[model samples]
Target chain A: MIIDPSIIIIEGLKKIIESGPEFKITRFYQSNSITTNVLLHGIDILLVNPRMSKTSQFTKFIHDCRTENENMVIFALQTSYVPMQMMNLVDGVIEMDDDPSVIISKLRNVSCKTESANLSDNCELSSREKEVLVLVAKGKTNKEIAELLNLSVYTVIAHRKNITAKTNIKSVSGLTIYALLNNLISQTEMN
Target chain B: MNKFTGRNKFIELLNYNPQLILMLPRFGMKLGFGEKRVEDICEMNNVSSFMFLLLCNVYSFDDYMPTENEIKDIDANALVKYLIASHDYYLNHRLKHIEKHIGKIAKEAGKIGDVLLNFFKEYESEIATHFKTEEDTIFPYLLSENKQMIPENIDLDTLSRSHGNIGDKLSDLTNIIIKYLPAEIMPNERIGVWFDIIQLSKDLDKHTIVEEKILMPYIEGVKGGSL
Candidate 1:
């Protein structure tokens, strides 16, 4: 998504980012008010104006999207000055003056590998993915898992997606049972 | 590359994808479609050929979405009746078929099987609520004498949003059987149930696409004064 008050800038960003197969403009909002449909598409990367992305109001909306797929990446589509505190919310900034290549590269850099668009036939979960899986199985929210692992929430989400791709497990109950069966977590450890 | 129009023969359509046979009874179609074209069968069954083909497109091709104009031509009553039949088929026939097999599989597998069954039961009730919401609320709005009245509780957006997780659990169930189920416990019966789960998942997904992409858009268009 490219959330900009200016339609012209959104078009420019769409043209630049869509040049690469890595990014496709899924949704754009001229006004800061985004409908709940943002979560519906399982949107992976969000390029929103820094002003709206950091608003105390939109933060909750962004957080609500995490429930769908925690692996979502949000970037600031920078068109003006951004405070450091505001910068904290985004994965990276796509500066307004940057060339199209520069913008696409910045977007692609943060985008995780869609390793299995279709679930992998033989998904071998990484050790970190296993850690995330155990946390997930225990019914820990992504934020809690992120803190426990001493990792960014974004990275934890990426791990979570990879775990799903590998194990084909989705629901917490199923993952918990998976943990129990695989001995990743004992029965007593699960909440 | 194209949709199955009235010109297509029934035998050829079945040959194209035999799984489409599942859609027959839902549309009030029956066996022995010999030498009959799509239109002929629809006429014989008192079904709308366009609606039948529209639904066939939905079931057969993921990329096929009817335009608002195309959807406007459909009889909303026929569409509702089709959806209601689909719900009945799901909750009564398809679900019962799986439950019978899984019931035996659950008995043989013990604790894990019991846990899986309970999860499935939870999913079943959610689906019941989901469909019942449509049947009790949305269906009446379409079929009611008063066309101007907005449904009291359920809206199209809410109906679409609520469709979220009923299908998710099916994936979880299939994965649990395939990836996590102890291989030792009733492997043959387990695999049999797995097949049923997958078939139901795929059908339910198409059912959702019909509701979200076609049905909701039609009603939204109606509200926008195109009806």
Candidate 2:
């Protein structure tokens, strides 16, 4: 179960995630009216812009949201222009103006870390399986990823099957949700 | 890059209100009222009055995202450059260009241009005055206070009224631009310019809304200790 953030700003951020190669963000919000208790109960990462006035209340909101749901990652939008004193409460602070490519890469890194953390110490995801998972999070189709990863269509299908079994996501879209909640590919990743 | 020193387009585009431009910096007050700084910013940002006129024509999402090379760092220089190249520069330029053409257009289009320009002129002054107050009082005080000092008022009710007026004006200007541009005017050459303008307007609209509804009220609450 992946919970997408409800208080994300930047008008097309959700669209950017959907059109992106790595992941899709199904839920998002731009204000405090989102009722984080209800809206963020199952969300993975809360991509917040501090310049948002309601942002001041966000840390407390996140704290409360996390009391019930501990898996959420709250990433604040940091800007060089903002005084440092203003951004003390977020779990992770990412420069708001950082290039989308850099952001996506960073999200991938976080995602990878979280996914590996879920492993039972064996790192059992075969190299091929992990590669397929990465591509799936990138929002690539089995056929498209097969062409890019240089494997047969049947091999790609097998890898996806193993990934679903390991991740227990039932479907590729659900796997994407799992990837995003676990810090796989962020909505901000798409340029 | 003092290429604009004597040109008609440049002279007419000269700063009638450098104070308005001065408030544009995102962080520090780097570009004061000096001609040299203005010129530097204009050159660095590649801003011109003509570009502002072109920006009024852009309306689509494809026009919002800057080209790859245009995305730069958010440093002091870059911030100033963005204000100049993206916001104030285009705003000042467009206002002036419209001022120049509206008189002529009013004569030809009857009361249409008059109605439109009247709205623009009024809102232009309102926005300019509001921004000036922020520059002279609010922002400077925040920088100096080194601590947040809320304003006298910070409630959502006040914010809603203030923003409603400002937002409506911006919406009117945007609608006019999208509706008025003739189909034939070397539209492609102007495409890039309009894209930047639309983005600037969108960002400005969002920024002002945040400031009035969120930040201003928060500052007020902090100052008054109401929240």
Candidate 3:
């Protein structure tokens, strides 16, 4: 899905992308069409230009899209710099002036990353265990995680030990970086 | 004729390959060479003498490859900026023009079109992210004086490895459209889309080769200088 106000950009992306058969353009809409309900269409990726609107609602729209689908890959297309606050909302950012071929190459890379991450959804961690793993990855001590989850320190420790044994990644920093790359924790949350 | 110095007039070279005009606007030169030698014009326009010569030589002579001596003194930063501008032209102007025609084809194809459209979207997003990495991360690292600012895991080899075959998917799409799709709806329009794909695929392949062979190696040399 493409969500940008520029008819030219939307059309340009559609032509270059559809030229190949690997992906399709489900819908292209102006920013006004972006609502929580649009997520129901099962949009896996959204190319948006958040800078089109100066209102605070633009951020909210991005937040809503993310909330609708946690795994949906969102890319911001901007002519100049994308503000740091706006960067946090999307998976990646592309300069509007970038070569169209370069843009296509990026789509391939992100799709592969997304597919691989989805494949790992079948990993052995239970939902509770995954929760504990995320907290640990976020640099929380056992006691802090225990307080947050309302569990005893021993329980948190056990979960941490189990995560290590299961994943064979014992270092806190390793798990933290893993959580980050895997999208288990947002950069904002880490801060 | 010497590929580099033999071409005395800009108009002479422009006459050979009209497409070289694309570089003219970038160099702040307007059409009409006005009887000036390439060297004199480049100097007067504030364009790098080496760059204008190199570009003319590359574009004009078939099978002409730049020797180490040819590009040794060329400014890597200026070359990169020019490459970025080419990228901008494709993304902002050319691709958008192709897209409008695609939208028409998609609307005409009806319910069955959704599948192809979805695939295109996925491909589009992938390309966008790939460029983003280069523009936001790799390019900055190349241009910056502080090599320490680069992430520990990111080296030239790793970055090069990330340049996957984006062209394959486009080929697949072309095959599907040309060989597989039924000819019920606007067959001419479908063929037009295939042509666009072919053009884009060729352009993308050349672009990647230039980056991998020329640009990345140049940056690597610069990085070695800093270290």
Candidate 4:
């Protein structure tokens, strides 16, 4: 989504985005006020020249965009610089004179990050795995966990493999921190 | 990653994954192999190629798993020797090396630095204790000659739990350094410590899996292959 008032800037941005398979043109709104009425559910990113409109209005516009689709990434368009205040309002800034490669790479990075975050969000542990994870974090081996849970050792192993797959955390240290960070174990349980 | 065979050159292993350099010292392997094949080098070092490749696969490939035959053929003595060497290298070499570098940065950062240093010290001691448990109890029981150690707290069920305690501490140390440390305090030094921590964490994790997947099953003498 491009929200610049200038025709040349929009075309240039369009060329930049289309240069890669990573980004696409969603919808363009030359006027910031019009976007408030527009449905933004499907828009993944917004490339807007918030400077075209008043700073105060850009804030409100962005706030409205957030309510409509909070997952959407916003990149403030800048010629030389976007004010530090406005820079805080978006995920990144795209200078008008930025190399096309630079612009694409920045968007690509943000896109990959958003996707991985969604993956983590979807990776919910089953209660049994959570039980296994807390024990594993506490320092229990598979045999002990199996004995404690009254399951076969193989069953415990399967659960561990599943836990690793879902979380994509392969290391014991990684999983332990995962459990700790997720509050499955307390700070005192860190031993 | 393709499974490495005895035909693969020893130096080629490094080319395949440079991080295997860390794995080498554990197996008592040192640099200076110009063009020796894997089996040749293994034979020279008295290291089993089967065990070498299995460890290599684990270290190099993220999703590598040994076949049942591979598991059965694993040289237990060689594996244990490698693991014990790995622990020594980690404790005496890598951890101390990182501590030296991190201590310098920690002192510069003042109070927060002391806290970080102490946090690291706790982790270091915890790792020493963790490895000591295996070295003193588990290894003794596994390598028992008179079969006396098995009857005295010889059960190794607690092995998995201890592995994570140290691993998690290393990771938490990383998180604290990366997330909470003031950016004003040397960024390069912070990154230096951060990289070493991540690398060591990864190396430690690899070490854990070798014990868990290969050694644990081997220890149980479990006839059925699972996990």
Q: What TM-score does each of the candidates earn?
A: 0.69, 0.32, 0.47, 0.53
- Candidate that scores best on TM-score: 1
Weakest ten-residue segment in model 3 chain B by summed lDDT? B159-168
lDDT of 3: 0.65
lDDT per residue for candidate 2 within A15-51, as digits (tens), equals: 4444557665533443434342233433556666555
Query: Which parts of model 2 are misplaced by more than 4 Å?
Result: A1-13, A16-191, B1-91, B101-104, B146-149, B153-165, B177-199, B206-227
**Candidate 3: misplaced stretches above 4 Å?**
A1-191, B1-8, B11-21, B25-29, B32-37, B55-65, B69-71, B146-155, B158-163
Strongest candidate by DockQ: 1
Candidate 1: Cα lDDT at B187: 84
Model 1, docking class: acceptable
Q: Report the alpha-carbon TM-score of model 3 versus the true structure.
A: 0.47
10 residues in a row with least lDDT, candidate 4 chain A: A32-41
Global lDDT of each candidate: 0.76, 0.47, 0.65, 0.74
Question: In candidate 1, residue A124 scores what lDDT?
Answer: 70
lDDT score of residue A115 within candidate 4? 66
Ranking, TM-score, top scorer first: 1, 4, 3, 2
Give lDDT: candidate 3, residue B211: 64
lDDT per residue for candidate 3 within B41-148, as digits (tens), equals: 787778886886776665554334465555456665667676677677666665665566656766776643554565565566656666666777666665666654
After TM-score superposition, what is the CA distance of residue B140 in candidate 4 from its true location, in Å?
1.8
- Model 3, residue A60: displacement in angstroms? 54
The TM-score each candidate achieves on chain A is 0.58, 0.49, 0.56, 0.59
